[model samples]
Target chain A: MSGGAERRLPGHYLKSKEMYSLPGLVEYRPVARYLFSAGQAQSRFLDGLKEGKILGKRCPRCGRVYVPPRSYCEYCMAPTSEWVELPGTGEVHTAVVSYISTFRERMEKPEIVAVIKLDAPGYTKGGYEFAGLFHKLCNVEPEDVISGRAIGMRVKPRWRPPEERKGDVNDIECFEPVES
Target chain B: MRPNIHVKNKVAVVGAGLTLFRRRMLETPRELAWEAASMALESAGLTLKDIDCIVIGTAPDAFDGVHLNGEYLADGAGGVNKPTVRVYVGGGTGVFVPIAAWWHVASGLCRTVLAVAEEKMSPAHPHPQGVFAYIWDPVLERPLGPNLIWIFALEMRRYMHKCGAKKEDIALVSVKNKANALDHPAAQAAAKITVEDVLNSEVLVWPVNRLDISPVSDGAAALVLASENEARRITDSPVWVEGVGFTLDNTHWYNRELGYPRYVQYAARMAYKMAGIERPWREIDVAEPYDPFDYKELHHIEGLMLARPCEAPKLLKEGHFNRDGDLPTSPSGGLLGVGNPIAAAGVMKVAELFWQLRYEAGARQVKKPVHRGVAQAWGDLMQAGTVIVLGN
Candidate 1:
């Protein structure tokens, strides 16, 4: 073990080499592609987004319509029965500005992300839990995300043009604050 | 006999095996799993034909660049044409695999179970750091442009603030674990380190430096578990799984205080209760708490009830957590020194305990005799705690 502030640790030297090599000793490969059941749920959600409409599933037993529809109620442990269509609107529960890209590499421009809590029929403080989705934030400055002002701000989904619409998550351009 | 509470039969880990931990490997994830599983089966004098079920544990599919990872690695783990179950709780998944295997055997449903945990962090395209992106909250947390180190740094800061621990005191863990890992065969980051070296290490975030963290590596570990009767029939020195506990807290991580891991404490309490241990701090002979980062080991040491919440750092500074200390912790060198294959790392710790309990640790044995040991793995958005108590 070396001493002194001037001497860098071994890891620092390794970092300076510009190559962080990781060993891949194991050999794993998938024989078949797995078609997860969750894909159906995701498809349904995307379909709603393409139509510029937000959809939710209502549990007859609990009478709570989840903004991002679920096949079953997580709490009551029962299946959801009805599908409800609603406007693409909600409030930003929280927001952050990311200076790094998805790969953790520094980016030239930062991207804004937010969690929107959509309007729902459940009562109480935590009841709004079912009404949330994660997406990009637009028409908002990065400073707004840092100031603690982005949270609880009303926002609405901005969809892509109808011609460009696809049955995928990116169908919506972004979500921005309502001028309330 | 109850469906949820207890199993009809007792389960024992008959054998365990692991490949060398390395910073990088050419083998894909399945290859690691196969090598480890093959070794474990060989040690137990059994073949895949003897196995009745399979259970796998891996941290994240993103690290391997494969989604639905359980099925992806199934064939290598010997899960083909068998009852296979994959369980994950972040780093805790390794130990949890055996726990799951125990249930399969203890339920009288399977006589022999093969459990494997593998992680291939090398496969990620742009460094595994890209994979870490998904761990953040897509809306709130991800937007902050935070590095994975940010959370660990925050935790280390909170621990130091609450426990009155200095960076030097916490750095002792890094030194000790690295030194211990020097003897570990699969260790990727083992070194003869000193506290000064740790202090001099590059600071990733304030309290946490490069030395204070574990290396990202690719590795796999496997264990063969069986019912008590089958265990005795297979091996003379079987390590019994005395107790298992797992608990998951809400994801509102920021809502709760961070000084102590109540989730880990609760999980340990449950396992201890099942093991008939009244006082864990005194009963546990050796321990391996999750140490993806150095302070995490100390933080988990307290969470495992091995020491008073704030006393671990002090005890650590005094060399009480060393292999030759009164209570050896992470005699296998731990994740910080060995390697953090995530799920595989946790299982590696459990395997070390099994070796220690049976006096099969060879050169890596603790200075003192070991009778009872605990291995705990923590994961998720800092919400999952999984623990296993073992004995000869």
Candidate 2:
């Protein structure tokens, strides 16, 4: 019944070269393409962004507004019945500077990312949850993030030119600090 | 939430087994499952013929490069004609596997269940990080081109900012878990490392270094669960399943406070209540909070109420979380030192606790006399929290 006498655990480790060079080793690249439908609420929100406005869905039962609007409220489980236009300004909830790109490759210029808690009025101030958007932060130095100054700073969306605006989350080029 | 009133039978863990955690293995995913499952049956003095049902847990099909992986792994998991089910909640799938099996036996629907979890992250070409891209929302988050580490880094920053914890304090977890894994037979990332080694490691994201993360791994873990009567017949020292709890938060992770894991708290509260444990900080003797990232262990410790909010780092500094220290956490080296095959890693934690309770952890056992222990896993887009409480 004693387990101390049991030998070491785990399977054998295979080196990359050893694995690839081995006969009968199969490799495949999946071509998974999809045309995802931006649901009704998100579609309307995207269209609003194309016109340089931020739209949120408000739940009639809970009066909670969701930025990046969903058709229903997650807390109340009620269908969102109202559309509210926000000023597209908010404070940074959290932020980080990325030194590497999505593919794990080093980037020439590091990007600053933050979760912006938008100026929606339904939820309590400094609550556990909020209506927020995740986007890049511009006009902010990477040192601002390392120094912990980027978080909780007021900011506004820097929208792309109206003529170049696309019906996507990218319509807002990046978020920038709102000048006093 | 109140306790469920429908349970008619008690469940006990009779045997547990694991395959070696490695970067790449010659065995296919199913073969890995079969190896672990077969060992578990052998340990419990049973075979596929004695199993009434099977529960399989794997993180994502993308990692294994196979769809319907549960059905694909059924035969290896000893599920041919028997009823089989696969449960997934991102990385939480490992602990959730045994949670699902606990229900089968506790409900009196099955006499014995073979709970198995496996993950093979090596199948994805280039790197598994490319496969991780699919977890993000295509419409909103995907446009930003996020690496999977971005979210962990963001959460780590928030934890540091909110709790007044520094990077040095967090590196201690990496130091502790990897050293713990030195004795683990299945460990792939186990090493003798220092905090300076962790700090000087490659920085993938600010506040997260290469060593701060668990290495991607391929492995499998299996456990045998049976009703009280069946467990008594199978083994003299069956670890009882005191309680199981799992919770999923809304996917709008950015909209929530990232400082603490509310989902994990909810799941832990449920499990503690069902186990009749009102004071977990003292009652629970050992623990394995999910630690894919070092800070996550601290985040989950507070979530599981093993330590006061923001108190884990300070306690960890004083050796309160070491194997010889009080309330030792992640004695199995956790995901950081033990290697993370995602779901299999979680099952490994549960299996560690079962062994610890039975005094069968060998060199990996904690120093204190252990009675009740808890193992937890957190995953999905910062959503799912699965917890299981085990007792000898």
Candidate 3:
């Protein structure tokens, strides 16, 4: 944008694999460690997951429920003091099939993920604000997602055994269709 | 929100500069910043001593593999002792750099400001997407093991469904932007390709093709901002900064509708009001909407109100947004064509407008008689919108 192509760009181009063999190239790997706290609302929600219960916090002002709940409502900005145990059921608002993992490695079997719009009392269907969870979907094939049959299908969480639970969101293995 | 109507001084862009954008760079991050900073200073006909302050814009520390990046880039950005500050909003940092510099001069705090943006994505091992994996909510989303492209693909698919736009319609953006990039010296993925080339490219996710995305890049861009009095002494053709606006929406991206960017609209309205321009679709002469993805350009076009909702694709198909069309957008090949170095990409667009408004862009200049130009950047989980309007 500043100088014309005549001045040329000021960098060298290298292929992904070329860097290893290049001379004088210093390779670095990050060794930073992290200890994350799930915080109060999320800690309580994880405990509910370990017990096969889906929990949300209800905003006293807006009556809006939040999953993976927050301590306060973003809209109402009021403290959420009431804890609501949800029915652990919702329909898929949107879904996608991922063939790659976090590292860009191809998977043997694709995973279907979705934003499940969880139902709550006094909540209108398809409102802008609603309780939702981002999770993996089981018992649903990739083809089902492509054909649009997976979306809008009611689903419930399939929890891990209580003995194996670690008070984590993964305690629920994946959300599968109600029939499944 | 209306910007402060009683600003102390008007700000103008006296000069701009950029280092070539490439997928991998042999130069270190500091070196990249220095190269761009020097070019910008040289263009303004001023030495480093003339600058009163420095504003640096860069993305995450993970990309550079170095913590305290702002401090690390101090020497390169000429911020040795000057009041230096780094402003970041993910990809929005590019344009936000100048916006930060504008206030420095506008407030009479600094007579001259140097704004620089640099990103070193190549330093990250394997791929930078691993760094982006940390952007998600660790408690709820990390457990799902989602790929970065999955969210973009979901948004693309939703936009396609709601707008009734086909994959072919979206492919046109890739074709147009890449062709425009053919003239860009720093373009990493520029080519003379057809829509079939985009559709036939390797598919990463269902709706996202390899060509549909911008290449990972490492580079830097910079601009020199001066007050009205200082600018007149430097260049006779200074591009004035008319107005600036930024808005950050809620981080709960999935909680809202995916078809349109409501945050961008809010930001655009704020900017247009302060710029004293009504009916941006008819008044604004040129625009550079953020285009990290092909569809994103069209999505942002609608958000900018350059075209009506779900009307960009139709206007695009008719060549209304071309270099010679009614409204020329992204004539600099944009991030889709040039490269995406996170923060540097947005600065590149604003720099392009600087050159175009001055009629100094030899080949990349649009055909229209330009006057008012708007540049915008969207970032931070699709939650941030930053806009700057410039006129000559």
Best by DockQ: 2
- Runs off by more than 4 Å, candidate 2: A1-5, B1-6
Runs off by more than 4 Å, candidate 1: A1-180, B1-6
Cα displacement (Å) at residue B155, model 3: 1.4
Q: Point to the candidate with the largest TM-score.
A: 2
Which lDDT tens digits does candidate 1 get at residues A64-108?
666566688766878887777766777765555555555556667
TM-score, one value per model: 0.72, 0.98, 0.95
| DockQ (0 to 1) for model 3 | 0.54
RMSD of each: 8.5, 1.6, 2.2
Per-residue lDDT of B1-392 in model 2, one digit per residue for the tens? 33565688899999888999999988899999998898888889998899999999998899999999999999888988899999999999999999999999999999999999999999886688888888899999998888888889889989988898999999999999999998888888999999999999988888789999999899999999999999999999999999899999988899898999999999999899888888999999999999999999999999999998899999999999999999999999999998999999999999999989999898998999999999999999999999999999
> Candidates' lDDT values, in order?
0.77, 0.91, 0.86
DockQ of each model against the real complex? Answer: 0.07, 0.66, 0.54
Best by lDDT: 2
State the lDDT of candidate 1 residue by residue for B105-156, as single tens digits.
9889999999999998876644788668668754335544456655565556
Candidate 2 pairs with clashing backbones: A9-B185, A9-B186, A10-B20, A10-B186, A11-B20
Total colliding residue pairs, candidate 1: 23
**Chain A only: TM-score per candidate:** 0.76, 0.93, 0.90
TM-score of 1: 0.72
